[model samples]
Target: MIEGPYFVLVVLGALWCGVAAGVFVAFSTLVMRGLGALPAARGIAAMNSINVAAMTPAFMVVFMGAALLCAVIAVVTFVLWPEPGTVELLVGCVLYLAGSFGVTVVANIPRNDALAKLAGDEDSERSAAYWRRYLSEWTLWNHVRGGAALAASAAFVLSLT
Candidate 1:
């Protein structure tokens, strides 16, 4: 049987992964749509603000903390290979670390950075074009993040069984 603290971390990590997935789902399903409906400048401004504001300590606890815990689980399982639930735990870790979090760092964040650099003037052709690209591209990666996070949660749940 897994140790108590390790198990708790895994479960908490899974819950946090679910929370991250829900955030992405909300963006894909409603938030992005609502932003898209607004005027280009306003939408871009709103999204930029959201991106900046989302860096709060609370969000970091969930996002970065979950990833950190999941990573720890991965490393521990790696060292303790041949354990009963190691495979499932490893799968969950990989999905969260690479697919969900990696995508955010590699794809979504750079887009956010680019948008942040802009003046957010929708009337400006350059800003307008950037907003258009940001909406579609960001939403697409958000879907990926959501799917990966859900998969990670499933794997973590499997590890429990």
Candidate 2:
């Protein structure tokens, strides 16, 4: 069984993953919905502002820190434990790294970037069209990210038990 500092790391990592998951959940549950209900250009503008504002140091410390911790947990678990014991940790690690972090980098960030470049005009038909696409596409990927985070959190916790 995991003990000492490694155990603490595992728990902290899971907690961070859980926190990250909660942020995504909030976005999926209400934030996006609220934005979507606004006029398209307004919605898009709001989202662009949110995307820009979300890059604060506090958010990155949790988001990227969770990814880092997951990597560390996977490596340490693999080295310290046998097959079955390490399995969940590795699974959690992969989900966080590839599913959560990768999707954010590969899919969501690009979408946010594209949205940022859009002109913020409430009456612009083009803005409306872009908002339609962004709302659907971005939210879909966010669900993936949130689900992966929750699953990774569960996996890490399971590994400890």
Candidate 3:
């Protein structure tokens, strides 16, 4: 018989992955903006970076990695994609992963590193200047990353119909 539970799993996994990705983008935007709001905010952003660094390695290694593993297993479980449902689910999952990696690797980490270094030091012209630079640059990329996540989620939901 065609697999039903596995089929449901794919759809649901895509749904949840999409949701989690949207949340990540939102929170990152909030963090970026919060950091931008004040001269003293660099320390907050650095703390947030430590939060991000703590979170990302584990997420990249475990949760997102597990989702990828699930998608790979789904492909192998049925000789062909069991349904259009599966193809859409897999594509949504890929978009979520790629978009997420783009944010974390491309945008956040470098900003985090810069924030960490500057926040680690005292208030100074260079440190203040560095934070100002991050405020402008980081916020722009966060929006792009957030949009990618929103698109991924919308596609995942459409796949359910």
Candidate 4:
């Protein structure tokens, strides 16, 4: 049974993961679709604005704080091997760190960076082409990260049981 500081940490981690999941799921479900429905230039501009806004301190704290907690939990889980909830804790950490955070860094951010560099001219063939690809690819990866974050939250909750 999880207890003491460890239990508290896991609970915090669960909450953070759920929050991250909610944000990602919003983008995956409604946000991206709404942006895609706009003109190519408009979509590009909106996404770029969103990308910039996402870097704000509030969002970064939650997103990166969850990652930090996951890392700490993973190391502690290993150090205290054979403990109850070890497997669940480890699963939760890996799912969040790799599936959610890792994909964001590896797959999504690069696409956002590329999109940010575009001129966003409605008549530009290049902007339109990239926008089409970005809409599909970015949203696909968003779905992946969102699912991972939710799964990680569930695993953390199970650790307490």
* Runs of candidate 3 exceeding 4 Å displacement: 1-3, 40-79
- Ranking of predictions according to TM-score: 4, 2, 1, 3
- State the C-alpha lDDT per candidate: 0.88, 0.89, 0.59, 0.93
lDDT of 4 by residue, 36-146 (tens): 999999999999999999989999997899899999999988988889999999999999999999999999999999999895465588999999999999999999999
Which pairs, if any, clash in model 1? none
Cα shift from native, residue 45, model 4 (Å): 0.8
TM-score: model 2 vs. ground truth: 0.95
- Model 1 per-residue lDDT tens digits across residues 72-105: 9998888878888889999999998998899999
What local lDDT does model 1 show for residue 47? 85
Lowest lDDT sum, 10 consecutive residues, model 1, at 116-125
**Taking the tens digit of each residue's C-alpha lDDT, what string does model 2 give over 6-113?**
889989988999999999989988999999999887888788888878889999998999999998888898787784547888889999999999999999999898
List per-candidate RMSD values in Å. 1.3, 1.3, 4.0, 1.1
Which candidate's TM-score is highest?
4
Best by lDDT: 4
Displacement of residue 5 (Cα, Å) in model 1 is 1.8
Which ten contiguous residues of candidate 3 have the minimum total lDDT?
61-70
Better TM-score candidate (1, 4): 4
lDDT winner, 3 or 4: 4
- For model 3, residues 7-82, the per-residue Cα lDDT tens digits are 4655555555555556556656676566566565554555556556767775555336535644564464445566
lDDT, ranked from best to worst: 4, 2, 1, 3
Q: Ten residues in a row with the worst lDDT in model 4?
A: 116-125
